[model samples]
Target: MRKLLGIIFLLYGYPAFAQADTTQYRVAGRKNLPENYGRPYVILISADGFRYDYATKYNAVNLLKLSAGGVASKGMIPSYPSNTFPNHYTLVTGMYPSTHGLVDNSFYDPHRDATYNMGNKAMVNDSSWYGGLPLWGLAEKNGLVSASLFWVASESRVAGIPPTYHYKYHNEFSNDRKVEIVKEWLQLPEAERPHLITLYFPEVDSQGHYYGPDARETEAAVHQVDEAIGKLVAEVSKLGLPDVNFVFVSDHGMLLSDVDHPIPVPELVSNRKFVVINSYSLVRIHALNPEQVRPVYRQLKKERNKDYKVYLTRHFPKRLHFRTNADDRIGDILLVPRAPKVFGSNPPSKRKYPGAHGYDPKKVPEMKATFMAWGPAFKPGKVIGTFENIHVYPLVAKILDLPVTHLIDGRSKVLGKTLKSP
Candidate 1:
């Protein structure tokens, strides 16, 4: 028994003789370090499709308590084309889809001669489609261990390194199982334990899509997720890790789909050569002939009504911070539909979900997501105004004390108000 314990201690950097006093032993190289040697530990959680108002609307008691005890935001506006994959990556990289190369949930890259889609596991695991360093990669490079419970891009080797510990995404895992995994990681020896962690919950988003955002099913999902959060908090407290910081956010909110008002894609463009990437709330029209771009834009513009609007990517509104790159993956022409309306090649009967996202964050109230933080690093009882989701990465980098090694659209100063001095 003694020999086995010694081997375990050697491998994990624990003090073998004093197993009961696990808290006194530091990491291998971090012994005798000052109190402020490293940044506060962080656990970033994403409740997929949890809208900004869900806390109040569903009476998520745990979420409300978290908000009142820490920093809360009125809303977190997602980047343009507010979808799951793009916005989730934006939250970690602090770059817009245009900059990060994840232009949409699915896109065709002419340079790579490849089509990338979220459902394609090979494409998702391939690092060729991802641009910039994710938080886990950055943390690993800086000598901090990181873990992910199904965060976007964490399963792949970004910046040439995956998270120190991670699992392949499987929505079948129950929330209790996921929380237990997180607790196990937290219980590891100091050297092997992750300093940065991310947890993703997709139940709220899934329920919203199936039953509509305002349905009782969606409200029940919100309640269930809140209870899970409470359980996680209790576990953390039981472990006595008081220094751990927590950030809760969602990629985008849900809007009801108007089955009666599907935009007629075939009527808008008779050209068969045009590639239409329809994502319900937004549509990207790729013209085979560059000359057809303007004509397609004009035809779509003629059909524009209160339900939708059309624009040439080159002339896309500067306020959107989109179309900044000449080689952007976005199509030549953009089609943005108003809330409850959608753009698709097929009729509404073929569509599956009653709720959808990927709309203009500024114009649609339903597309705004949630952002809340609690820990020693953040100020208590502070309510911040709405801000863009891209800014989240900088705040995370700041919390981890990671150097800004790459270009990102987020400015840390924008979120500085949420933090208290260390």
Candidate 2:
């Protein structure tokens, strides 16, 4: 990894942060913001657990409109585990789960000496808990106002600065309210305008978790959210904001799971019980009782169960690139399920549905999501084909002419291959 970083540095010049100071940071896509021009806003909307197939099946017209008329990828290639926060952070920072430091949906925060879950805004939004900067923070530093509707960690004060307008997590509200708030934020005047904006809808993911990936419930949730997206786009288009862009994407796809797929660790090792933890990429187990450690370790090594695969901390696959040092955020022992199987929070009797991610990155569909963009600044009806999530940050940077930062793991490419370069 050190060697790779050295090579990257040699090829790309210094990391974007190597040259700057206290000037409010500006992200790469907002250089068009002017005293006279309204801020060049980019609206990023994440439809959680929304599959590409469902998008068309449910007639997500707004999404398809953006994809058909703008630069859209066939789909996005996500980092492993494909859970929410890790993938969301990946979208904003352009780094994989391993590099950006938010490896899973849940993990023990050693610095604070507490367990943090992605669903808890208080824990996930704490700036100290995060290692990378979201695009809004960079925009704020560079003298542009930014806002977030539901993106996690958007509430934190990065480098002691917060977005000009922000609403903390409020999942209880109706989708109408979420749309209203976003419309209001977009309606702000030039001086008060948010140069960058982000929003998320977890209803689909919630449904997918409760009722397998292809369930009618999940499809309804997808359609409901698609209507909300349509509303947002219609509102934005009405505003006549110039040089605007909208990035529509999902964190990752979901996989169906069943109780029959459980690989019983306890059965493998006598008298040892593992503490299974919730995370985005890897299934982590902590040995609560020291006496159980050896038995559990032996069971994990000797067992050849088929539902999921276990790996010693040191031997986790090369693609995940998980840092397993004692102090690292991942767990002592990692478990990853094979395709179509998932890790559940609760045991089977009460388990209602089957769907999980955090699988191997090499898992074809699990690692692929979606990315589409449309705006006056971006070329229309273009297809960038498949792309890694990390490239998003650098592409945004290049579009905005902002100084690049080392925290990013993405690179820029000609996103609009079908349209003439402006």
Candidate 3:
């Protein structure tokens, strides 16, 4: 009963996300090559919050055996502020969150004078809020068809295009159905088939958020996702499609944070002087006026301690890739709290759940993501060390033979070695 309720919490927890548009959407008349069946197939799978060690720790038999036959990474690194929306977008766009304009899961955009929150359906589907060319859009632009069962910005018309086949975000969609849909996509007639497909899973992340990463619920969630992936692979393999490949990854990992004695709402700076978008994992402070920036910065800095660190936009660690070469979307002041100590509600009531993420993965090694690939395209039984998630974009592009027209932070060389030589 506890596990069942946890599943419900992850899948149906958000009343706002449960919507009427659960049906699959298609873009009619989008044609690919004359001989599309010959094109390489890449099914990109993301199991959100699947920590680097969970597969081994939880004994995810199918995934371990599958990855063992192919290439597995020691771990995959997420871009700074290891949140979901930003890192997922980065994985597809080959750009850092700051560079890509999703600086955080929730942020203030001064130019637009609006905030982009992951939960706000209007902001989520609004193409203006997103930046960078997602892989589906990349494939579509290059005359190859693409599909997304679910992904950040997939519902949005990113890069002025959505995938040929896609679906709006919803939690009720079952894992079995998603794999069936992917199979149906590949089973399509040649010209109408999607060579590149993206699928996302939220079960693991959900359980991790509600029950700490090591809890039985989380372990059950991991095993469930593992079984689903196993089913997906087995079903797809029966089709005997040529040159088919599978790349499994996660947006970021999970961590256990102290729910008691949480970081309260910023009381030092006047609320009127600044706008605070506190997601608990981190906080973004937006100043109402440029003149008020330093005054607020100083106030927060003086109070900063082991609990959290405050950085003005200009001073965010260069390695974070957040401060430099950024769009105005990044907050005027960034507040990053350390592990087991997350930003919290006023009066500091104990949080309902102990599990959390969005910490700097470098500092919290558990926040590091996972990466593995198997198929005709990957080098068998190889293992590579940690590499940034940004490079995943270029690797997928190279697999589908799509051309990247714009500049991106991800370089093919970072992950090019894992692929079989052309």
**Largest lDDT belongs to which candidate?**
3
Q: Give me the candidate number with maximum TM-score.
A: 3
Taken over the whole model, the C-alpha lDDT of each candidate is 0.80, 0.66, 0.85
Model 1 residue runs over 4 Å out of place are 1-38, 268-272, 303-306, 345-352
Candidates 2 and 3 compared by lDDT, better number: 3
| Model 2 CA deviation exceeding 4 Å by range | 1-39, 110-112, 267-281, 286-298, 324-327, 344-349, 414-422
lDDT of 1 by residue, 21-97 (tens): 11221223421123333456899999999999999999999999987999999999999888988999999999988
Clashing residue pairs in candidate 3 are: 258-340
Off by over 4 Å in 3: 1-13, 16-19, 324-326, 347-351
Per-candidate TM equals 0.89, 0.82, 0.95
What are the per-model numbers of colliding residue pairs?
A: 0, 15, 1
Comparing candidate 1 with candidate 3, which one achieves the higher lDDT? 3
